[model samples]
Target: MFVIDCPTHGSRVLLSERRIRALRNTDTGVLLALECYCGHVEKISTGRRAPARHVPE
Candidate 1:
């Protein structure tokens, strides 16, 4: 769970896993595509983790 300042909501909004549309790993952190209860889509990054490495077959 994470909190985001939604422009439409005008305050911190709680985002659950169910609200997540997609997740992507970046150099800095994880990018999350979330949809708010009011149908607003926003992207937020949280925490830093190493990016995944691909193993060639």
Candidate 2:
């Protein structure tokens, strides 16, 4: 599970593994594609590194 800042929801959103569409490993962290309850898609990077900019689709 993971938590992300959802732009549409305007707060922290909880995401379960079932909500994950894709996951990619980066040199700094892991990139995750998550679907929100509102059906919004967002990409987030997580790990020991700094979080990347959120990409919404």
Candidate 3:
């Protein structure tokens, strides 16, 4: 269970799998398809990645 912000319902609690519409893996994080009790659906990504640095020879 996690907390997600829903536009229609303000901050909402994701009770269980019931709130998960879909999920997939991303290069940097997991893409989450979340649904609020108000039926609002949104996508969120988990994890963070720093920008790649380029080195000049």
Best by lDDT: 2
Q: Point out the worst 10-residue segment of candidate 3 by lDDT.
A: 48-57
14 Cα displacement, candidate 3 (Å): 3.9
Tens digit of per-residue lDDT, candidate 1, span 1-57: 866667899776888889999898878888888998888888766655745644222
Q: After superposing candidate 2 on the true structure, give the runs of residues whose Cα lies further than 4 Å from its correct spot.
A: 26-29, 47-57
Note the residue pairs that clash in candidate 2: none
lDDT of 3 at 17: 73
Candidate no. 2 TM-score: 0.64
| Candidates sorted on TM-score, descending | 1, 3, 2
Runs in model 1 deviating more than 4 A are: 49-57
Off by over 4 Å in 3: 48-57
lDDT for each residue of candidate 3 in 1-57, tens digit (9 for 90 to 100) = 756766686555555677889888768777778787788877777656523434222
